[model samples]
Target: MAHAQDASLVARDDIPKTFDDVIPGGQDFTRKEVMIPMRDGTKLFTVIIIPKGAKDAPMILTRTPYNAGERAGNPKAMTIGDAVPLADAAFVEAGYIRVYQDVRGKYGSEGKYIMMYPPRGPLNPTKTDETTDGWDTIDWLVKHIPESNGRVGMIGSSYEGETVAMALLDPHPALKAAVPESPMIDTYMGDDWFHYGAFRQMMLGYVHMQTVQKGAGAVTPTDTYDKYEEYLRAGSVGDYIRSRGLEKLPFVARMMAHPAYDSFWQGQDLARLMAAKPSNVPTLWEQGLFDQEDMWGANHAWLALKAAGHAANNWLVMGPWSHSQVNGKGYNVGPFKWEGDTARFYNRQMVLPFFEQYLRDGQPAKLARVNIYNTGDDRWDAFDDWPTSCAKGCGTALTPLYLSKGASLAFDKPADAQAADTYVSDPAKPVPFLPRPVLDPFFGYGTDFAGYIPWSSWLLHDQRFVDGRSDVLTYETPVLTSAVRVQGTPKVDLRAMTTGTDGDFVVKLIDVFPPSVPSDPAMGGYQMAIAMDILRGRYRESFEHPTAIPANTPQAYAFELPNVNHVFKPGHRIMVQVQSTLFPLYDRNPQTFVPNIFNAKPGDYQPATITVLRSDSQPSAVWLPVVGKSTTP
Candidate 1:
């Protein structure tokens, strides 16, 4: 059997990793490719799609790490509609020139690829950064593409959206408008990589999908069907990644090196960076109320710019969609419906008009400073500003929905002397984020709901699945007699203690539908979470510092959940779910304090008794942004 040199004997690691380009059909537009050179001599591959008879047209560009070819569709296909992403269809029809570029070191671009590509400074030794690249590309487009009207705007979702936000930091004169839809802003604080300091290990698959190769290489599917079983079997996310050799990726290794929210992560925070260098670029920050990946990006960026005095030109639009769902058909999320093709309506009414005003030098339309979609009643709400409870309040109050005795949620402060709920957080039986048979996030959860909704609306999943779990502690109000509205970020004032030295806390604000519905009778007693978040125990005091908690110590864990524009209709109940682990969604905290969780030993994984204190001295409650104190008992 000495056949080591045999051609047929292929090593498992030597197997080819092929990536397929999944793009829409070909289109009738004039498509062309160019290698636009940057100041550093790196040539970024760009795809330009000019509409039929285009002349003096404003350009709408999307700079993406994902292959531009994949985003621009096949060149050999048929109609104009088939040329670009569905989100660009409206702009294309409106006679806008569509352009897509592969960021440096991705696809046909030439340069070293760094995830997020930190801005040019001490962190980035070389001169080139995302901002420089954006400026260079825009300069090239205005000079070379004679068909362009010398006016350009940036628009994209997800990673592409992040690029747009990056460009705004050092915007070119031609860069008139920007629309960052569901952009990933910060990794460790609030965005994809981690929530507070709890590592979102579930997103490890995304590392392979993005960073394995130059093009978007397909992530190898797990041997096991359920990710829960796979992740659980590996013990730790670090173990799983190390076992697969994924830790070798630069970004992965860098992420592992800095578990704390140190300079490595903070240096790239878009919101913070934008605050330092506030731009006058007219920005329309689009956020999906239930965006699974990037609920924090656009919101924080909007707030930072406003607070930094770059307020007037900055606008916000939060819709009742999930992660970039506004780019696709958005009639509904989960079992809820929004009457019409809401995505189409948004593109036509808001996007097209907004771009027309800034890019095309057209009449400025009347757009609200902060336009949001109300979930409970399914209507859009326009406001002059946000958080309605800020400085000059807008009838919004920080109403504390206190966790009370006997598993009740109350508007009044808890008067109980020693009312507390205790549960054993066994790592061996960590609760699942969604019901078991949790699938891979790499494959994606499209907007589809047959028997179950395994898509972007995962947050909107019914809380009833984990309602009875011993580890999960749920508190709810009695059936509401009147509608209650929550219109901003809900702060969690968690008074908790753990038997172990380390722990995690997940909080959810849910709106429980009535037990029975008249018109949609099948849709009864659904517990949809309006806002949810998690915080790692060590980062309780400072996100930048990690400290060990004294065993059996009562500590306060405070954090803000993402923005919400939800209402609790009459007959419905308000709910608050408290738990230690989100399971595979976030990595196990291991309970025992260790120097590094990545290198935690098996013995570190201990079962801890978690207590939610509801006493008058240590009252646990979620501060809701109640619109009017209108809820009736």
Candidate 2:
């Protein structure tokens, strides 16, 4: 095998630099591609990159559904084409042998692909799943790979991250450390597939990307520019899938069949699986505060591991990043910028040290139990433990910001006993989740002739686009007298009535930028959404047994938004926007009562009069986790 001596040996100077440039110079590594056979006789294509002249170096293994050797086929220089680079130069500089493998049925690997393969007991040796395959692969690498120190560590993000979590279940003896970044632990709960029983409309594009498209080189299925219109025209989700001739897609079909949280969904829940066979493998859970896909997984997994009394080292690190930014060293999200290169800092200060300590027996890691990047404050905060075990005694308290008359968000409870707000929610004219001229290719099809904006950036976009819309009820607190810090989860307690049998409620907690801040002139009065979530009214009582709301009957609905660490500066005002629909991002509720929304027809979609009650008896409010005393002058 040829060894990489310099960039000239593999990549041409004339070519533009890619994510692979993160690997530092002066390191010579050799790459070899092989197909490793799993216990079930499935051949998983694996790529091994070993630092030359290193004796007994610890191995870092990453199993991914994404093609592993697609771009990095050459031994002289490994380059990842469009896929984001996994580890930084620190791992290569530290002389760790890196191994990347294509999981079962992905890329060159053999066997049928089952998304989020269910965890089954190892009692049956003949049967194989991700856990068994991971165990077998690790066992094979430790024994067959030359110059290996026998210690192994696993790390990946997104789908690959789920693979890392899967390795934790019945791990091999050589597997010493595991870092699962933004893994999807559950689909139906708070992860990518569903939010409070509401199916993610974006899953259409995602499923097509993974299932129908066989290889890394596969182009997006749609040629149109407006994905929203395409979906809208396709009518109901079931109709959309059938119209696209995707009814045979295993995952999509299964997802539609199980509208409620049933045994099928529960079987794929990684958090629950981890509790069943917990491994204390010195795991580090990394998540992004603004991760559009799997933010809920890492938190739930960490909590489950703690509850299971797993003794090995476990820690959590969160940053102001999107699903992809967690790996890159960027400090900005769209128009919002942070203080430093948080991703680089995390890799250098926390991630590298973690692997060194566990995989190489280097200096002991001094990382806190929980290290989080406070977004608004633009600083890192360390806690001995999450939420409850912070420096401050009780961590933070829920400060209720009530929805008051005059469309105001006040700290005090509502004074009026009969105050209420009403709006007409029409599926035909649903509120745009992002500003007009939506450039997202998923909304139009595969082309965004207008500059392409990554979906993750939408989280940080200004909310002013929908603030003036009558369908969106806006409430804002008076310009803050002092900076208010919100450190934990925010909950929305809503009291409302819908004319339709079923409805969807969307709430966004925003930071209203003051005009004085000159970071960006256009940012003046920018309503930056810090946290938000949605709930399908039919599933209010129980996710397992959904019941539709009776017409004109007021009901209480509540759901917790993802945890956040943000500060509303003194000059800025805290705002909350409430709406029934977030087009394209989530499927529009048909409003009419139906046994299965997936099968609902176009006639099922209707406009309904939605009323939000803010009376003294039913005060609708957003509860924020206020931290520390007011920083008022």
Q: Put down candidate 2 lDDT per residue, 504-608, tens digits, no spaces.
A: 999999999897567668888888899999999998888888898999988999988888888899889888999998777678789998999999988999999
State candidate 2's TM-score. Answer: 0.91
Cα-based TM-score, every candidate = 0.93, 0.91
- Highest lDDT model number: 1
Candidate with top TM-score is 1
lDDT of 1 at 29: 75
Query: Which residue pairs collide in model 2, if any?
Result: 225-444, 226-443, 226-444, 227-443, 227-444, 228-443
Give the alpha carbon lDDT tens digit for every residue of 226-307 in model 1.
7788888898777888888888888888888889999988888989999999999999999998888888899999999998
- What residue runs in model 2 are displaced by over 4 Å at the alpha carbon? 1-27, 71-74, 78-86, 121-126, 217-220, 388-395, 439-452, 631-633
* Alpha-carbon lDDT of model 2: 0.81
Worst 10 residues of 2 by lDDT: 75-84
